[model samples]
Each structure stands twice: as structure tokens, then as C-alpha cells.
Target: MEQVFFNEAAQDLKTIHDLLRWSVTCFSAANLWYGHGTDNAWDEAVQLVFPALYLPIDSQRDMCSGRLTYSERKRVIKLIQRRINERIPVSYLTNKSWFCGQEFYVDKRVVIPRSPIGELISQEFAGLISDKPQKILDMCTGSGCIAISCSLVFPESKIDAVDISEDALAITKKNICRHGVKKNVTPILSDLFSNMPHKHYDLIIANPPYVNVKDLKSLPHEYLHEPRLGLITGDNSLTLVLRILGSLKDYLAFHGIFICEVGNSMSDLITQFPDIPFTWIEFDQGGDGVFMMTKEQIIDMINLYPIFNV
Candidate 1:
């Protein structure tokens, strides 16, 4: 792809600047919510196609406004208009989203990588690696973003990414190849732990479908674009969570840790168990619905598992 370029400014051309000013005016009128954002998502969109971008408003310092010829100015306005019309997230249109300050590929097939897990992995589990896991399992690894981040952070550890869908696994493969971690991150098409080999994983991590049926249906448009199988849980999100909590102890090695992201289901998990002690993890970036437990903890807390008809 050619780097977007800007022609030399026309000293005598007032028409170009006038058109651009009106274009931004129209963009602000149509996309005020996005225009006013700190990241300036709309302004960024304008800059992508219109490299000679400069606006007079709120940009009192560096690189905010400039002159774009008619064609360049027209392109940026149309792009922002397309975003407003389609309701597709600007992130998808850009084919990128920030995770742990690193840009990653994302599309409608996979959920955008927003889990705080990325931030956690950046600090190498926040120096939480008293016992370095030899083998790691990423359950329901949709786009394999988590697996790729883990492999990058822990260069010596091997990773296994499991999911039931071939489409998701295919994307996972793409990311593995993109990040060049194919040798370290293995992909498995499995329903939970059903198809996984009974190997002892030092750390088993999951960001499974914990959104209850009703809750899943009401997610925002950006989230609706993602695959529901990895986000929705049936018969209450408890079904899948309990299944993992019950069977995880069997698959984890002694001193092994199990990390699961249950999101809103954390409240439900607590109400149901009443006494199940789960370690809620905090991320440097924003995220919720994640909890941690050990193999010994799982064994001791085994009685709290709810036997649901999954």
C-alpha cells in the first residue's frame, strides 16, 4: 500500500480550503459524538485519506489543520459519511484496534480485542509469574489474539488455543502467522475442553461466552458484529462457567492457575455460590469479568460447582 501523500499547498487556491472547511462542518454536524472524542476518531479518518488535514477548532498546537485539494478533501468527507451511514465501527473500517498499545488485525468475523488481558500480558502477568507456566491453554480462543499476546510475552512458554468454530480458528491461524508465533501457539478446534488432550496445562485461561441469552441480544452494534458463539452462554452463563470450573481442575497441573473472563456473569457467579472465593484481577487498561483460581483452590471449591443441563 502506498503511503498516503499530500500535494504541495496551493498558495492562491481559496476554493480547496473553503470546501474542506465546509466538509468538516458537515462531518461535525453528522458525527458530533465521534468528532468530539479525545482520540478524534473522525479527525483521524479524515487524516487517513486526506493527508493535508488541518482543522481550526480545538487544535491549537501541532498537526491539526491544513489545505486539501478538492479530490483529497472530497475523499475524507465521503469516508466519514460512509462510516455514519453504515454504522460500522471506525475501528473495523480502519482494520485495526489498539491492544496493549499494539495494533492488531480485526474484522466482522472476530470480536475486537478489548479485553484487559492484553494489558495484563504486557507486564508479563504483572510479575505474577512466580511459577512460570510451561504450557498455557487459551479456551475459546476466538481470533487467537490472546494466544498471540501470551506467546509474545512469555517467549519460552508454549500455547494451545481452542475454539469450536473453524472460521474463528482460521482467523486465529492468520494472526499466528501474522505475528509469526505459529511454532509456539497451537490452534485446536474444540468445544471447550471436549477435544483437548488431557495434558497438564500450567495455566488455563478462558474468555468464554459468559453473556446470558438476553444480555447477548442487547449488546451494542459494534459488539453484535462479533461471533455470538464466543460471547453468548445458554441456560444462564452458568452452564459454561461451571463446566470449566468443574473440569478445569482435572486438566491443570498442580500449582497451575485457571483464569476465566465471565464479564457480567461475575455477579451471577457470586449470587449462586455465595461463598466461592474468586480472585478478581485488575488490568492497567479497562476491562472486567475476569477471575483467577488455582488447581488447589478449584479442588477445595469443587463443591460449589453448579450441575446445570448444558
Candidate 2:
């Protein structure tokens, strides 16, 4: 890739479209990772440019042709430089991320909200859940996006958003308040379900740190900016997952649904527990490594073996 040179003398580079194009070029040249919130240079460019210019991401194409002011140009250039050089995720740069069609404030303190669990929340867990969840638990909730989304989806439900990191819980509180779901969503400091042994939920959703030790070392530079506690698990990436499964039955309602995203550890999960029935969820919007199981299914598995003996 040729080095992207930003030329101030170029007259054609005055418009938003020009800056966006230049950003895309620079991002591609730098080989920046886009798995944070976007999957490609173009989308990442849009995310960087649109937010910097105070424009909506879905703004009209004609708006892109609008000329950028001198200050706007400088700001966009600086952002692009940091993006390329620091390998920071655009969401962290902008301090904002969108999940389940809702916007939430984000920073390095919490992982960017990119969980596929959002797809299930958007559908209100249709096929998997029959009744409207009265109690919800967003275990390992980073920015509390899942819990906040659930509060909106199930207006009558009260949600507990738990995270072991106080910093993450602080951010989660801000997001819950930002989304105006503070009344229904509570941020709790807990290492999984440790702080809520007696509490139970009708629906429990988690996007835990399932990245294996080996994969963690090989993650792109952009991912390195995120908190390690929110990504790495163990050698096989099933340490925390197994712990969650072991204690899940005790905290789930009679007909509760437990949904979790194990990322690349899905294969390991299947291999480790071949007898357990794990319903891998498919998303039309594009995401994988998530699975769902009902309370009854968990109970049956517990009965068959001492799976939950941990």
C-alpha cells in the first residue's frame, strides 16, 4: 500500500466527501482493524467523518459534497491521524457507539458495544422467550448497552447490569442514564453472579470475555486498546463460560432463557460438552458464536451429570 499523503494545496479536497475518501485511503494504507464497530475502511471513514462534522451517519449523499470548514478539516485530519497511528477504534475516538439501533457513550473503560446479542434483544427474544421478561440480567455488561436495550424492549422489566470492573460499571451507569433507562437499569459491581447469588432473572444475556489466551496475543492492535478483562478468558476461552453455566441454573427463572456470546470458543464449547444441548443462534444482520438455552434444558443437563457441580 502506498503511503497516503494529505495535501492541503489540493482544491478538490475541501468537501466532506473528499475528507472521507482521504480517510478511507489512509485507513486502508495503515491496515487498521475494523472489527470494533465497522468491518471496512469505508464504513470506518463514514463513522469518523460523520460524527466529527456533527452529521448523522445516514445523512444524504449531497451532504457529503458539502464543503468542510477549515476547523472541520483540521479536526477530521487529526482524528484520522490518531486512528491510523494509535490504532484506536473510531468508537473510542468518538466516545460513542450504536447498538440495536440505539446510541451509547463509550470509551476505553468499556468494550465497544459490538455484541451479536443485540440482534436477539432487537427481536425481544421472540422464538426463544414466550413471556415478557419481568427480570433481566446483563452479566458482564460493559457499557450496559444490552441492559439498556432490554429496558427499552421490555419496558416493564427491571435489569441488573453486572461487571467486575468498577470502571466499566461507571461507564455503564453513564450509558444507562444517557439512554434514560436509569429507572429500570441498575449497574452492579460483580464478578459475574457473585454479588447476586439470591437474585434471579427471567432472561439472562451475556457477551463475556471468551477470547482464548493464544488468540488474545494475536488480536489486532485496535483490539488491544480495549480492557483485557473484557476479552481474554483462559487457554480454551471457556473458563468464565463454564463458571457461568455452572451457576446459571441457580439464578434463572423457571422458564428463563440464557443467552451468551462465546465468540470463537463456540467450537470448544460444543466439543467440551457434547451431551449438553446448546442452541446456537443465527443473526440475519451478521454475527456468530452466540448460543441460547432454556432453564429446563440446563436443569436436565445438571440432572444427567454434575455439570453444574463447579
Candidate 3:
């Protein structure tokens, strides 16, 4: 039984190193999927164990040999078990996630912040937008990570973090407060641009649901813990994305740029709009299916594809 293993681990696992090793072994044996924050059992073990012990993620190697208190060991054991049994991502377990080298609060209400858009933000969206944006929009801003990160990068800019789900907006507000971007980041409850202000934005970013029905059904168990509202992009997958593209020109300034992540729906987007020129961004840090386009391009695309002119 799990209780027996807990007792044995509590008795036999003498130090952080022992517990970390045990966690890695258990995770590997369970064949847990690791895509939220970490990719391997060892790193996943460290993420779960170090945080449970209130130890710094960058704690020295010597600290691994240090003994853990009974309570600390028990907490780590329970978290590890929950991760394996529930197939929850480590960030959700810890209520923490990182983007653009900054930490944010997250839970089941929002998908864990792992968008490749962080790399683009870290570079200040260089070469994409010619000038500093005075206004920005983060569509489908779940945890408000993208909007908060942009606010930090462009403190002078006013940002709108829009999400249809009130629960998600709550998380977004929590993150906005956590990151101290309350002055610039405003959370709005809207289905895409339905309730957005009439003014146009100098920059627009989105990480909307783009998982196709086929891919959704085959996703790893760990992904099942994330909200369906934040993952499924309708049965055809391009439904929400097409709507975004259709209405994007209304919100994007003349010189502004639009960025979005469609994940595996990249093919669907291309198939649906073959002539639209979308510049797919390549990240050195590693992610795909994110693309960037300018306001002019969206206008042109709409002109060519009138069906997208909603």
C-alpha cells in the first residue's frame, strides 16, 4: 500500500539526496510525462523535492546530503505520489511557474506558463516591432504571465489581459499582483476581442487554445490536468484562431505586430489559409507553431480571404 511505502521512505530516506533518488526512481517507473516545467525524472524529482523542503532551486550540492525533517520528508513524499497518481504537472503541484525568467502563480484554472512567446518577450520582441509599443494586448491571457512579462519589459506600456473564463481571469489578476504590474496590466473578461476597447494596440500577443480534437485525444495524461477551455480550440482546432485573425486588424495598430501560438494547429492554419504569409518564428531555446505577422499582413490576408473578414 502507499502508506507502507511512505512509512518505509520516511524511515529509510535519511537525507534530501535519498528522497530525491527515490522520487526519480518512482517517477521513472511510473513513466510520468514531464512537459510543464521539466522534461526528465531527475529534474522533475528536484523540482518536487526541493520546493517541498522550502529549499532553493539552486541549492548547493552539499545541501542534497543534508537531512530533511520528518514533516519535510512527508510533504515531499505526498507531492511525489500526487504527481505520479494524478498525473499533475510539477508547477501546478507547487503553485509556481516561470516565464521570461520571472516567476508567476498558477493552478488548474490556467495552463502552466510554458509558451515559447517568453523567448520573444525576453528579446523585447526585437526586429518584430520597429518601435516601443505604447499599448499591448494579451489575448486568452490565462495566468497573465505574457501580459505581466510584457509589462515588466515595457513598463510604460498599458496592457490588456483578456480571457473569457472568470476563473482564469482570477488567476491572471493574482499573477498581475504577484508581479507588481497592477498599474499596467488590466485583466478583462472577454471572449477574444468581443469586449475589448475600441482603441487599437501597438502589439498583440495570444496563446489561445489550438489543440485539435485528434491531438487532444492523444495528449499525455499530464496534459489532462490542464483546463479544457485553455487547450481545446474547437473540433476543427482553427475555429478560435481564425476568429482571432479575422478580428485582429481592428485592434492592431498600423505599425504594430501580431504574435500567436497555435501549437500543433500550425498545419491546420496553413491548410486553411495557404496564401497568407505567416512568419513562423524559430526559437533557439526550442518551441514551435508560434508565428508573427504585421497589421498590414492581416489586412492583406483579410482582403484576399474575405471569409476571414468577420
Error of 3 at 292 (Å): 0.7
Q: Cα deviation in Å at residue 142, candidate 3? A: 0.3
Residues 189-213 of candidate 2: C-alpha lDDT, one tens digit per residue? 9888888858778999888898888
Which residues of candidate 3, in runs, are more than 4 Å off?
Answer: 60-62
Clash numbers, per candidate: 6, 0, 0
**Predicted structure 1, TM vs. truth:** 0.78
Question: How well is each residue in 7-120 modelled by candidate 1, as lDDT tens digits?
Answer: 222222234434445445544555533311124544544433333243433342333344546665555544555555554555566555555555466667776666767767
Top model number, TM-score: 3
Q: Model 3, residue 285: displacement in angstroms? A: 0.8
Q: Could you give candidate 3's per-residue lDDT for residues 113-140 as a string of tens digits?
A: 9999999999999878778899999999
Give lDDT per model, in order.
0.69, 0.86, 0.88
TM-score computed on alpha carbons, candidate 2: 0.94
Sorting all predicted structures by TM-score, with the top scorer first, yields 3, 2, 1
Q: List per-candidate RMSD values in Å.
A: 6.6, 2.1, 1.4
Which residue pairs show backbone clashes in model 2? none
RMSD of 3: 1.4
Which window of 10 residues has the lowest lDDT sum in candidate 1? 1-10
